[model samples]
Target chain A: MTTTTIPTLPAGRTIKLGLSRIRYEVKTYFRQGDAVFFSFLFPLVMLTIFSVAFSEQSFGSEAAPLSAAAFYLPGMLAAGLLLSGLQNLSIDIAGEKGDGTLKRFAGTPLPVLSYFIGKIGQVFATGILQAAMLLFVAGVVFQVELPSEPAKWATFAWVFLLGVSTSAILGIALSGLPRTGKSATAVIIPIALVLQFISGVYLGFSLLPEWLQNVASVFPLKWMAQGMRAVFLPEDFASLEQGGTWDLPGVLVVTAIWLVVGLAATRMTFRWIRKDS
Target chain B: MTTTEPVVSVRNLHKRYGSFTALDGVSFDIHRGETFALLGPNGAGKSTTIEILEGYRDRTSGEASVLGVDPGTGGLAWKARLGIVLQSTGESGNVTVREQLTHFAGFYPNPRDVDEVIAAVGLQDKQKTLIRKLSGGQRRRVDVALGIIGRPELLFLDEPTTGFDPEARRQFWQLIDSLKQDGTTILLTTHYLDEAAQLGDRAGVIAGGRLIDIGAIDEIGGAEARVPIVRWKQDGERKSVRTSEPGLVVAKIVAQLGEPEALEIIRPSLEDIYLQLVADHAAAEAADLMENAS
Candidate 1:
């Protein structure tokens, strides 16, 4: 029989649970072949295809020139972040909701905050691996040089962290938008694809129309792509940017603001069960 | 907690979704160390009532206390003392049974050994197999194992044996019987009346969103509903008499017709009484509708 007095849990129990959940999330995620191929491999495959296609081309002026492969490196990295953080998390969580995983957890003593920590931790871990793979392929096959200065690497680290964080939170918020698990990929893929294109991942940022660039500027993906470009491109390659400068400050402001917005939206929308269920 | 204090108390609980009333003024109490079965047909609000008590859904109006705390305001500490096996299995299909159990065991302060839970559910042979590869019955055992792994004081089993074979179900009943012996307060919901008879100490029968009867498993439909009937064929007509003294009625019949043809005494089973109660309630409701229409 249940005791009249409820027992208090040990201190740091939630943290321990959250940390263990990360292992579960990662293990389960890698087991799904479809999730791995689509979220983890799609960007790398695209980079390989694009790099070979533009092998003969050169970007930037003679003073600080860049090969076409190096130019597309940052764009592919940005797309990888979006795929791993936003696209993957949204679809995964929506499936969890539709298939009753969230409902099961809701009945347990697991804290909702801990669940988020596990998810975001997954995104962070996968994002690092995706970045490393992208960097390796770029360096070995394409002979693209990475930044050597500690400041440039420092910028890369923060940008990667902030971009992944913002995308993950927004993904959780967007999981509520799909009506069913079957329809989640159908709804999320188009949105992610459109963001990538508009944010200068698949196409050149300056080549796009002013109105389209302005629309992309309202989103964090555009800033994230620009920040990646700052870390990887030559100093004089700033001329290719819309403002003829690496707007690192602007990237920070926009990504941080989206992080806040994503948090607010998730708080408002996340549910263990669907509205109709 | 004392055995006299109800582990679960529900009063005037009502739940409405739009114009549809899912649960209407349902009330019951389940005491400590007792298994209370909520029996109903599909869409009879059994799940809704259970969900409200499990803190998964909110009631429109009601007073519900589970383990001395209102479910609406219960925290993680309160949830830790309860185990819920939802109607549909909700575990991730990617992990093995042992891995899933180990993961969930970490959530509770005091949990049963993962291997012991596995052995209890008779899944020792399939413990290392991925859950997705398991058969329906095996998957259900995994569900039961997860529910008991936390060593919950109060366990809620919602249609726990839905897909089990007869032999597996019997094995499950034995496991539940052991848990009962351990003094766990349990709330079970199932459409199988025999399951209720076998496991429940008391039952609440719900139909059309209302509890039609509540009492001990054998005495649920009242003494009147349980009266034995002596039936016979005489004068080319079938005759039957409802009587408490079924033996006396048989003797009187034998005296009158020198052993009437095809004579037999019919004692109502729980299933029969339950069906009769639901049918009578439906007839009464139809009459009320007709009067209102007129």
Candidate 2:
């Protein structure tokens, strides 16, 4: 055998590979019709249906009442982020694991972190597009007023980042729950739907029982919706909150906590090959 | 990097999941530039051994080394030295054939030209086609292309031609032959005994989680198993004799009985020897079970 010297591998190449992974991931995501329709367009469809159906209705206390479009806007935005980051990733990754994509990647020289970068990058790219479409429909088609104050926009940005980060990590961690690719949608959609309904995406948060409200508060979606409300609704509208305040700081804190928890969970559960394989 | 050093070595590897043993006390070595065929039936631990060597799965116990590094803790540099084609095709169907190869090619330090690999696997026409749209044999070609694009020193081909047509399988064999000429050490697992006979310099036959036999391709089942058998009908009785010189045996028989009816000499091929080996092992196992029961 001809003796060959193994080079000291470049440490910085992972980020480059990760960046390339994003391109393939985004391209692949748009090609899957089901994923494009459900994950990317589900929120817009829900927003349209609820806005037109309840055009005459208003939610919250009379002193701080908000129109249906305004009421559902924040809720749908939160749900959209959750769907893009958590629900989409969980199902997509589960399918990868089931179909041998993850197994193939595990055998290659590709870093595990690069695969994650691709996944999270796909979610972030699609999440932005989904958020934009939802907001556009709310602002023009439904005549819902968006936040004008730069401070409010600033709050929206952080809340959006935190929510997406937390949900995406949790999505990867939850991918292990489904036993097979065919079962992923069944396992993930129900969890996403339940979180949506209880987190006030489909109904008024304050209308639920106090006990249910407490239960909702324990998850990140409720805080995410509350944060979006702080951005889009009038400042005095905080009077209708469970605590009679938007609790913007609490929103950041809770979502950040979930982000940390999600990171830990993903570290423990993420696998290239299934246990049974 | 001595020429005598084995590229891969395993010492009494053992793996178990709960009560089921996947691989038990299996050991072998692949030298620098030889194609080593690992022949086995389904669930006989072929993939488990390959996966453990690839670092995709962990072994419960025993030591395994690939390219002088322990696979369980092999770094990216060590991994870059090897190419692997797993039993199952795993690339996403969404990406075009060329796109998938290009993506994987970026991961390695010394990668072959993507188009060259495409041609090598006979997928030049399907380069722009989405993998999902390709036929099963075509998708398998993509898997083979990806395996070679890394230009690896050691390649693991796990049942690579499982879905290929006869023509495609022949073309794949030629591709493997070229790789062999390049002095790339390969460890291949396949159900096709002809493929092993055509490509392997040496072989290891595994059965029921154990290495039943290991040696040069022609010598795997031992001399006794390969002895040519002469069969003839005499006095309404079927009879056969095993001998190294079937021609001499037939001459004696012809001289004795003036050409007895239904006479033939059967030269045991590798497939025949392999089957006999597996059957003998199964019979031994059944007898062991019976003995234990009593």
Provide backbone clash counts, one per model: 0, 0
lDDT of 1 at B78: 90
lDDT of 2 at B173: 97
lDDT tens readout by residue for model 2, B181-217: 9999999999999999999999999989999999999
Task: List, residue by residue over A1-277, the lDDT tens digit for candidate 1.
Answer: 5477778988888788889989999999899999999998888998898888888787867777778779889999999889999999999999898888899888889988889989999998888999999999999988999989999999999999999999999999899888988799999999999999999998999899999999999999999999999999988878878889998999999999999999999998886765332
Q: B158 in model 1: Cα distance from truth in Å?
A: 1.6
User: Could you give candidate 2's per-residue lDDT for residues A106-176 as a string of tens digits?
Assistant: 77888889989999999999999899998898889888878888999899899998899899999998999
Which of the CAPRI classes, incorrect, acceptable, medium or high, describes model 1? medium
Identify the runs in model 2 with alpha carbons over 4 angstroms from their true place: A1-6, A58-66, A274-277, B90-92, B230-241, B248-265, B290-294
In model 1, the runs with Cα more than 4 Å from the true position are: A1-3, A62-65, A274-277, B90-92, B229-266
lDDT of 2 at B97: 92
| lDDT, candidate 2, at A51 | 80
